[model samples]
Target chain A: MYKFLTTFLPKPLANIAMALWYFLLIIMNLYCGIAFAQGTFQYVGW
Target chain B: MRLLIEAILFAIPMILLAWTLPKKYVLLSQIIITALFIAYQSPLSFAILGTITFGNYYLLHKAVLRKSIKFVISLGILVLLIVSAKILFTIHDHWIIPLGMSYYIFRNIHYTIESYNGRIQNESLLFYLAYNFFLPVLIIGPINRYPEFIRDWQRRRVNSEYFSLGFQRILYGFSKIMIIGSYILSLKLSAIISNIDESKHWLKVYLETITVVLNAYFQFAGYSDIAIGISLLLGFRVMENFNFPFLASNMQEFWSKYHMSLTSFCRDYIYTPLASYFRRPMLGVFITMIIIALWHEITLPFLIWGSLQAFGIYLAFIFKDTPTSLVSKNLGRVFVFNYFCLSCVIIDYELAEALDIYKTLFFIN
Candidate 1:
């Protein structure tokens, strides 16, 4: 049943799932860049 | 009374940072926060906090038995508290409602649902209390589930690696919140958000909106970072919160990347149950979103945000299930997904403001 559902679901979902993995990879880089940004922060005031 | 004093005195130490003084003395800081008042400075706030804590304790204690009826009862109760707080706060303007009630509600829900799902067979009251009120993840969360939380606890008998790793995560998180999140707030760009007068230009609004999104990421993700970091300092191994969610290519993938613990929690408990609502494989995926939005405590803006996300997920479900490769590209998917998410954040601002901005974004204006 599970296998049949996957087969019938079409290729777009697979493409999306694959795209999502790639997207996560890109986000990892963006996150690393952002994490290192703003060398200092002021916790209290504006 | 306590919340007032803390919010007041909190300013001084926040500037000086009580956290910096002695990492080992966190227990003392908490005791000081608690020793301030019988009720939260405001009565309404007190009720919300008290009620949610009641929900957390109530659900957790009930989870220990592993009985089917009690298990069901616990989840139902936790959900009820979440909805009640959100409704009361939103429609009635009940401010200072609860400090970390929503997050703890998730914690409680996690324990209950995990017990019901057969993921958690063993638990003790002390461990459960610590997990729920760990104080680090308490305010903002990485949203720990009980089974995984229990496993981590058992495995953490006495490992310095845990401490070392935990501190690294904490310091990094604290720095993120303190440095990165704060830096954005301090910029003049954020000032435009508050002064949303008719004088505000379209370009300025656009700039402010971008700032708001960045600020949201930094502030919330920073909170998670702090939670992870502090939990580490205290010898608890809370899970990581953000996984570079912003770079997600599609809405579905973004959901998986962001607030991952909550996303999975809702997926397992709400989405799964709702999926069972009808036999159709393509389901009322948005139903899960309503639960997710309500998790923020049922405000109108939050409801809209949740609904918008549900819309995104529903669309993703349709697209993914259909096998449309054209819509799923690395750069193209990221633009669509984040644009969709940014649209939701716009709606989260205010209904009138959201409608106006939507008109402009869609070029209806």
Candidate 2:
């Protein structure tokens, strides 16, 4: 799927875009973790 | 959570100072910053870390030069510290687990073991303190090895590309924690799971299991990303803790991708040594997982979770030699994912409660 999405772009551009995609994915996870920790919500394991 | 906020507030000024200061003073500034940060967390934390830094330095100093019983004695002292700390945390309600105790203990042990085998040669007191108390990964860590961390520190670089990418990673981590982790799972799935006895819906049980897995991933990997990003901003490189673990097709692959640092640490420090000592890979695997499990928490459920994980790993190892069709591979992926989810549920709940949910999922209740 990733290959298909990047097939059209030049190699460098594709690499950069892939990097950005991964970056955002991590940021999203980090944001959720922080918010969860700060919130008064109950969670399972620490 | 408050620790994280305090870390950031504490780090900003130190970061600026390190960035603007003369090169020779950077290490000293980092040491001071780390000392102050740990002190701010708790005076006890400050004293504890100070003691640990000085103690490990002295022990490793003596241990690294030997190939005799004294080496054993030195290693024993370090292990004793970890074991006593774990025991004290369990038996005493008043014991605060000394900020970063788990992380730095593993780190000190790693250093001791690595240095014993001639993997690291540095004996610098300043570098040792700075490496272990590195503000970014001090609390939650990717667990950088002493040599690798020092190597990065010595040749630190702060280019615009690294700066932008580092900030980008930090933001991505925050998004994972605040948005996907909280909104998608904590608020919804946790609420549903807490009320599962009343619901008794198989689908909700399944969803809860899935959310448990996702929440664990986001929470851990998110912290790792933030840690790695902050390390990058500081012009030091910390190892990546997670890959795209959920996409992994088997337990072995999953273990390798998930918590890469800890897994590798166990592999290198525990599994390899024990396997050689005992001449049995399976025994080594079992012992390693047991240690890993116990490392997470001193509880019955964690032990069970570790046993389950070790079982999964053993199963994967057995199946590695078997030829599988594409269908089998897909089935394996599903099986592995579900197995992990169920085991995670076990970790979160009492055995009876967990089994009840499992029975409902199987339509037996």
C-alpha DockQ of every model: 0.07, 0.32
Error of 2 at B346 (Å): 2.0
lDDT of 1 by residue, A1-46 (tens): 2245458666777667655644554454355446445433233221
Candidate 2 displacement at residue B152 in angstroms: 0.8
Best candidate according to DockQ: 2
Q: How would you encode candidate 2's per-residue C-alpha lDDT over B18-75 as one tens digit per residue?
A: 7899977887888898889888778898898789778877766754555555457667
Q: Write the per-residue lDDT of candidate 1 for residues B6-37, one digit (tens) a residue.
A: 44343344223333645434334543443233
TM-score of each: 0.69, 0.87
Specify the poorest-scoring 10-residue window by lDDT in model 1 chain B: B1-10
Q: Any idea what lDDT model 2 has? A: 0.80
With candidate 2 superimposed using the best TM-score fit, by how many Å does residue B298's alpha carbon deviate from the native?
2.4
* Candidate 2 TM-score to native: 0.87
DockQ of candidate 2 is: 0.32
